[model samples]
Target: MLDVEKSVLYVAFGSLAEITIDQFRELAMGLENSGVHFLWVMRIPFEDEFLNEFEERVKGRGVLVKNQWVDQVEILRHGSVSGLMSHCGWNSVLESICESVPLLGFPITADQYWNARMVEDYYGVGVKVLTDTGSVRGFFSSECIANKVKELMNVECVKGKEIRENVKKLKGRGAAARSAMEEGGSSWDALDMFIDQLIFGKKKK
Candidate 1:
């Protein structure tokens, strides 16, 4: 990652999420075409020959981790990692915000859609891969992935610059959150009160 010139894109979906082989192929090709350095943590259990060939084709430009665990937070915190290709799970979103890594969200299901919307629309710290109809749901082709990946990774572009700026600001909020959990802070006081109540029961007014 240190050897990469600009910054590496880190890719991961949550543990249980799954995509069809076709979707996986499109995603892989899209990442390859985007012309960015990427590290993809592939957890989907599928036996496909294309996976090997794809890895060979990408070579130094991309790396795919098969059936393994990587420290996502550590990767986001690394200096060389500029963006995340994520499922937009709440935890992943929070981790990216805390680490100040911009997101390129490909939401799968459930709360992921809402989280992705918040990251892209509410916070402006990231972009969601959109379908042909401009909806985040529905089918995403290789072209869509390529465009969104390029959009998020290209800091010189207006939208990308805005996303990066937003992320920088959100990083400050993340710091404030950490401080609030520390001694003498509001979160700390709240926790202390809760613990006291749990231990001794609430006193009558």
Candidate 2:
């Protein structure tokens, strides 16, 4: 039931419901072409949404959506899942960052743009299908998706190595951010510092 031998390629398909047909095709084509692979959650997940296809679709396209991760932590820790294709959701980003998988980003919204920026800009660990079209739902041909995935797959020296190193750093950042919320953590330190600044600034007035 749990087999990590064949590399995992987690594709979060439903999240891209709003994307045009061409965009959807490219996404599927990209996953089909990514060279990285994934097994359906059924192979691993005991209770996956795929078992109920009718509820997931939006006008025949899945809406409540393609959540391609684990609820239990051990599933990932146990030599399963290798890579991810995601729409840059907050939890998705956090899970992928923590999972240490090479990711192909497809940001679909505002916060996603920020998440993608962190993955592409700060971490250097993920690749974005960089586009410069004027509109929101930018036109991207299937060929573009295939080519980008090919390029991402071919990244070996600089792109690959740099991304690998940076992903580790991102994990540290994620850890620290999470730690801050815990008691007596760096998060409180920053809050305390901010309060001190406000107190001093007000006193000067």
Candidate 3:
């Protein structure tokens, strides 16, 4: 699933609809440089014939590139995982919050920018990676990837602790929000009143 063993890094790229090779490489290099064990699921860049290039690289590093769908929940909660390289999609974001897992935001899609903004700006939960080229597709250096990954991991050490605390503070607000929409909550009451006014006014007219 998440491969939570200490120093083990599990990366999910295809989990979300979109991701950048540029971002992925940066993280891979980061983890490798920091002496962390890595599991990266990269989309085979070319056809079956070209896949050999990726295989050779994986072989060289003593790493495995798997495409098997992983149970992210089990892995994130497992305690061996130090951080996630995610696109900050809503589902992924919620899981990280629930599991108290750390994140490195490599977001690159619609609404993902807003999700990343919410995390880094208000939640204090993750770090956003900035690309030098800014192109959706570009040649990226693995060295840069490694450095950013190292930074995200180091920063996550403290921010993760803070996020857990924030969870406790926000859970109450979440419950209140739910309550406001239930059978007898604020939203329910408002809907009831509007229906009554509309029916009575129609009869009067």
Per-prediction backbone clash count? 0, 6, 6
User: Of the pair 1 and 2, which is ahead by TM-score?
Assistant: 1
Candidate 2, superposed: residue stretches over 4 Å from native: 1-6, 13-17, 39-78, 132-137, 151-157, 178-205
Tell how far residue 135 is off in model 1, in angstroms. Answer: 1.4
How do the candidates rank by TM-score, highest first? 1, 3, 2
For all candidates in order, the CA lDDT equals 0.86, 0.54, 0.59
Candidate 3 accuracy as lDDT: 0.59
Predicted structure 2, TM vs. truth: 0.59
RMSD values for the candidates in order, in angstroms, are: 4.2, 8.2, 7.7
Give the Å error, residue 67, model 2: 8.3
* Candidate 1's TM-score: 0.85
Give the TM-score of each candidate: 0.85, 0.59, 0.60
Q: How well is each residue in 53-97 modelled by candidate 2, as lDDT tens digits?
A: 323332222122245544522433346455455677765666666
* Top candidate by lDDT: 1
Per residue, candidate 1 scores C-alpha lDDT tens digits across 40-95 of: 99875567688878889999878788889889888888878999999998778878
Clashing pairs in 2: 9-37, 9-38, 56-62, 56-63, 57-62, 58-61
